[model samples]
Target: MAATDTIFALASGAGRAAVAVMRLSGPASGPILAGIAGGLPPPRRASLRRLRDAEGATLDRALVLWFPGPGSYTGEDGAELHLHGGPAVVAAVASALAALGARPAEPGEFTRRAFLNGQLDLTAAEGIADLIAAETEAQRRQALRQADGALARLHDEWAGRLARLLAHQEAAIEFAEDGLPTDLDARARAGAAALRSEITAHLADGRKGERLREGLLVAILGAPNAGKSSLLNALAGREAAIVSARAGTTRDVVEVRLVLGGVPVTLADTAGLREAADEIEQEGIRRARRRAEEADLVLAVFAADVAPDAVTLDWVARGAVPVASKVDLAPAPAAIGGTAPLPVSALTGAGLDALRARLAEEAARLAGSGDAALLTRPRHRAALSETVAWLEEAESAPLPELASEALRAALRALGRLTGRVGVEDLLDIVFRDFCIGK
Candidate 1:
C-alpha cells in the first residue's frame, strides 16, 4: 500500500467479457507500460500496441492509454491496458506488470491514493463506494449527488463559517489588553448560536437520507392462521413463505426484497404472534415481536372471519397498518380499534393493489427522493451531533479562551467529516469496504 510502489489491478469485471481493463498508478507507470507494451501510447488516447514480456516475447495485442501525473485519477501517472477478454491474457499481463516492478493493488488502494493526493474528500470517496453498490434509481441519484461534492460543499461552507468565528474569538481574546472593540466576544457568541441553529435544523431531517441508503424494513404480524404468510406471498408475487392450514406453519422469519416508489425495501413475514406452549413456536413468537419492534412499518393482520386478537389490536393502536385478510371468505369489519382496516383477500387477489399502493406511499414518505444533500451515514450524523455540542459549549463558555477552544474542537469534528485533518486512524475504517482497484 505504499504510494512509492507502482500498483496494478484488474479494474473491470472478472471472467469472460469483450475487454479486461488492467489499471496502473504510480511514478513508474509510464516506464512500466513502455517496458511491456513496446512503448508508451499517446497520453489519454487509445493506441493499439503489442504487449510483451520482460524477455520481449509477445503476449497479446491490446489498446493502451497513458495518463500523465497531476491530472489523472489518483493525481499520479497512470495507464490502462484494454486487453482481450481471456483469463490467460489477463494473467500474462499481470505477470508482466509484476516483472516490471508494479505490484497488485490492494482493496481501495487507487481511491485511497486519490484521497491522499487531494483529488477528493472523504465524503466523496464514500459516495463513490455507495454509487458502486447502489441498487435502485433513488440510491443512484443520491450517491451521484454526494460524489459530485454536494455534501462536501455544504459541510465545507459550515466549516468555513466556524473557522471565521474561531478567528474572531481568538482576536478578541488576544487584543482585549490593547483596547480593541469589546463587542467582538459578544458577536462571536451570537454567530455560534446562529450556526448551531442551522446545523440542528439539518440534523432534524427524520433520518430520511440514512433510511434511504440502508433501505426500509417492514414486518407483517398477526395471530395463528391469520393468513399472514398468504399476504406475504401475495405482496411478493411468489410463495416466499410456507403457507399451510397448520397454526404454526411459519416458525421463522422469511424476507423478500422489493422496490416501492423506486426505493428498496425488505418485507419480512414473521411467525404468527401467540401464546404457545411449544418451545419452538414460543421462540418464533419472540423473534416475531422483536422484528416488529425493529420494523419501520408493520402490517397488523386480522382474519376477517375471526375476532381480532388483543396483541394485534395493541399493535394497531401503536400505529401499525391494520389489514383485514381473507376478505373473500367473510366481509371485513368497518373498523378495528378505531382505525379502518385495509381489506385484502390473498386467495382471490382482491384489494392487493390498493394495499400495495398504500405501502408505496409510506415508503416514499419515509425515504424521500435523492435530490437533496442529505446525511447518508451514521458517522456523518455522529460527527454533526458532536459539532453541535461543541457549538453549544462555545455559546455558553464563561471565558473567551474557553469559547475559542470549543470552536476549534467543533471545526476539528467537521475536518474529520471531510478528511480535511486528523483522520489517520479512520482511513482504514472508511476504505476497508471498498472493492479492489476502485
Candidate 2:
C-alpha cells in the first residue's frame, strides 16, 4: 500500500467472459496507462486502443479509459482497461503493468482509497459490500439506501450536534472563569440528553436491519409423528426432508432457504421433541430443543387427529405458531394452546397457500422490510451504545471540563461508526472482508 505506487487489479468477476475490467489507481495511473495502452485517452472517456507489452508486441485490442486526478473514484489518477477475457490476455496485461511499475491492488484498496479521499463514509462503504452480496430485492433496497448515505446522514447529523455541544461546554468553562453570565452549560447538557434519547430510540429498532442482513431462522418443533417434516416439504415445494410413518424419522435438523415476504428465511425441520429411549434419537431431540430455543420463530405443530403433546403445547403457549397438520384426517380443535391453529393438510396440499401467507406475515413482523435508515451491523449497535453511555456521562457530569471530555469520547465513538475520526485501527477490519479490487 505505498501511496506513490500505482496498483492494478481485475475489477470484474474472475471467469471467462466477453470482457474483463482491469482497474488502476495511484499517482502513476496516467503514466502506466500510457505506457501499456500506447497513450492516455481523453479524461473520463473510453477509446479503442492496442495494448502492447514493453517489447512492442501487440497483446490485444481493447477499450482503454483514462480518469485523471482529483475527480476519479479514489480522487487520484485512475484508468480501466477492458481486455479480452482470456487467461493469456489477462496475464500479459498484468505482466506489462508490473513492468510499468504498477503492482496488484490489495483487497478493498480501491474503496479504501475512496474512503481516504472522502468519497464516502465507513457506513456507506459497508453498504456497497452489502449491495454486492444481496440475494433479494428487499436486501438490495436496504443496501442501496445505506450506500446512498442514509445511515451516514443520520450519523453525521448526530455528530454535528455533539460537536456543537462540546463547543458550548468549552465556551461555558471559559465564560465561567471570566465571570460572564451564560447558559452554555445548561444548553449543552440539555442537548446531550436529547441526542442520547434519539440514539436510544434508533438502537431499539428490533434489530430489523440486522435480521434482514443476516436472514431469519425458523425452526419447526413438535412431538413425533406430528407431520412437521411433511409441513416443511410442503412449504419448500420440494422433497427436502425424508418422510416416514414411524416416529423419530428425522434424526437431525434439515434446513432449506426460501424467501417469505421478501425476507430470506432458513426453515429448519427438526427431530420430534420427546423423551427418546434410543441414544441417537436422544441426541436428535437435544438438538431439536436447542434449535427451537435459538430460532427467531418456531412452528409448533400438532396433528389434527392426535392429542397434542404437552411439550409442544408449552412452546405454543410461549408464542410459537400453532399449526394443526393433517386437517383432512380430522377437524381442527376450536383452539389449541390458547390460539386457533392454522389448519393445514400437507399431503393433500390443502390450506398451504394460507399457511405461506401466515408465515410471510410473521417473517415481515420479525424482520422488517427495512424502509428506514436502520443499523445493519452489530458494530453500529455497539458504537451507538457506547455513544449513548458517554452522552449520559456528559449529561450528569458536575464540571463543564469533565462534560466536555465525555462529549469528546462520545464524538469519537460516533466518528468510528462513520469513519470521520478514530478509525485507523478499524480500517483493516472493515476492508478485509472486501474482495480484491473493490
Candidate 3:
C-alpha cells in the first residue's frame, strides 16, 4: 500500500549525544533534504553538507543520507539528517521537513510504513515492538528471534504442510466416484491427525513462551519474622526493602525483579500472615494471599524454627514449593525438607545458590524445553490455540468432508499469522504500539 504523505521523526534517542538523526520518508524525502542540505546524497550514501531552512538560513552543518523508493526500509524513498544533538537544532530540521511536506511520524509510523510496504511480516513487525519493550537479556534475545521471523518460519512450515494435505483431501472429496484410490481418504485422515498433533504440541508451548516474554511472577509468603523481608533484600542484591529481625517489619508487599538464568522473574515479599490488630498489616496479608495465588511460583518461607503447619500446607495444596529459610539457624522440621522442598538461608547466604539454580531451572522449564518453537505474543498464542482446537476436531473426524473443512479452517487461522491472508485488524493494533521513529 502506497501512502500519500511523507513522514519524519527524531530517529535517535533524545539525549546529549554528539549527534542525532532525524529520518524522513516518502515522495517528499528527496526534496526535503535538497531544501535543507543543498542536495540529496546518492541512494544508500551519506554526504557531508550544511543544512538550512526554507529562507536559506543556516541551521546546522549536518550529514545527509538518502535511500531511493521500493528498496529502503518502509519500501519508500527515505532520507536522514545527521544533525547536532540539540533540541533546538533537531526541532529546526523537523520544522524544515514539515514545511517541505513531511508530517510528524506517529508512534511506530515508520515501522508501520515498512509493514505496509511488505518489508516485514506482521509477526516480525510485532517482534520489533516486543524487542523494544524487552526487559531482560532472555526477553531481548527471544524478541530478536521473533523479529527475525522464528515464529513466521514455523507457521509457514505448518501452513505449507496443511496446504499440501488440503489439496489431497479436496481431490479425494471431489473425484471419489472416478474410482479414486480408496486409501486416499484414509491417508488424508491420517495426515490431518498428524498435523493436529503438531499444532497441539505447538500450542502447548505458547504458555511457556508467553511466560518468558512477560517474566514469571513469584510471591514470597510466610508469617511475620519468617525472614521474608531479608529474603527479598537478599534476592534483590540491593536494599530495595527495609529488613530487620523485628516481627511484622514489612507491613506491605514489596516487589523485586532479578534475572535468573537469563529469564526475568519477579519476587514479591508479602506481610507476615497473622491475627493482627493493625488494619494495614491485615490489608497486606489479604493482598499477599491474592498475589500468592497469581504467582507463577510461590515461596513459602518459614524459618527452621517453625513447625510444618497450616500456612505452608495451603500453598502446597496449590502446588507451591515450600522453601525453608534460615538453614543456618537450626535444622528445619523433617516434614518440610523432603525430596523437593528447597532450603536456604537468605541471612548467611547458605544454600542460596542452590535455590537460585532451582528457580532458574523451573523458569526455563516453564518457558519451554529450551528449543520448542514458542509463540512470543498473546496474538500468536490466540491464533495458535484456535487453530489447535480445530486440528483436534479434525483428528477425530471420520468423514473426509468434515475433516477437510476443519483442516481448511485451521489453515486459514495459520495463514492470518504470517499475512499470507490479510490481517488488517491485527496489523492495525500491532503497529499502533510502535514508536514513531521505529
Q: How would you encode candidate 3's per-residue C-alpha lDDT over 70-128 as one tens digit per residue?
A: 88988999988899899889888888888888999999999899988889888888889
Candidate 1 lDDT by residue in tens digits, 202-297? 999888888889999999999999999999999999989999999988999999999988789999999988779999999998999999999999
lDDT tens digits by residue: candidate 2, 1-438: 337878999999887889999999999998888998888789888899999999999989999999987888888899999999988889889999999999999999998898988878999999998999899878888999999999999987788778777777877888888898999999999999999999999999889999999999999999999999999999998999999999999999999999999899999999998889999999999999999998999998999999898997899889999999999999888898679998999989998999899988988887888688999999999999999999999999989999989998998898878976553333343335423232
* Candidate 3 lDDT for residue 11: 87
Give the per-residue Cα lDDT of candidate 1 at 146: 95
The per-prediction CA RMSD against the true structure, in angstroms, equals 6.8, 6.7, 7.0
Q: Give the per-residue Cα lDDT of candidate 3 at 203.
A: 73
The most accurate candidate by TM-score is 1
Q: Which window of ten consecutive residues has the lowest lDDT sum in model 1? A: 422-431
**lDDT ranking, best first:** 1, 2, 3
Clashes in model 1: which pairs?
none
Clashes (backbone N, CA, C under 3 Å), per candidate, total: 0, 0, 4
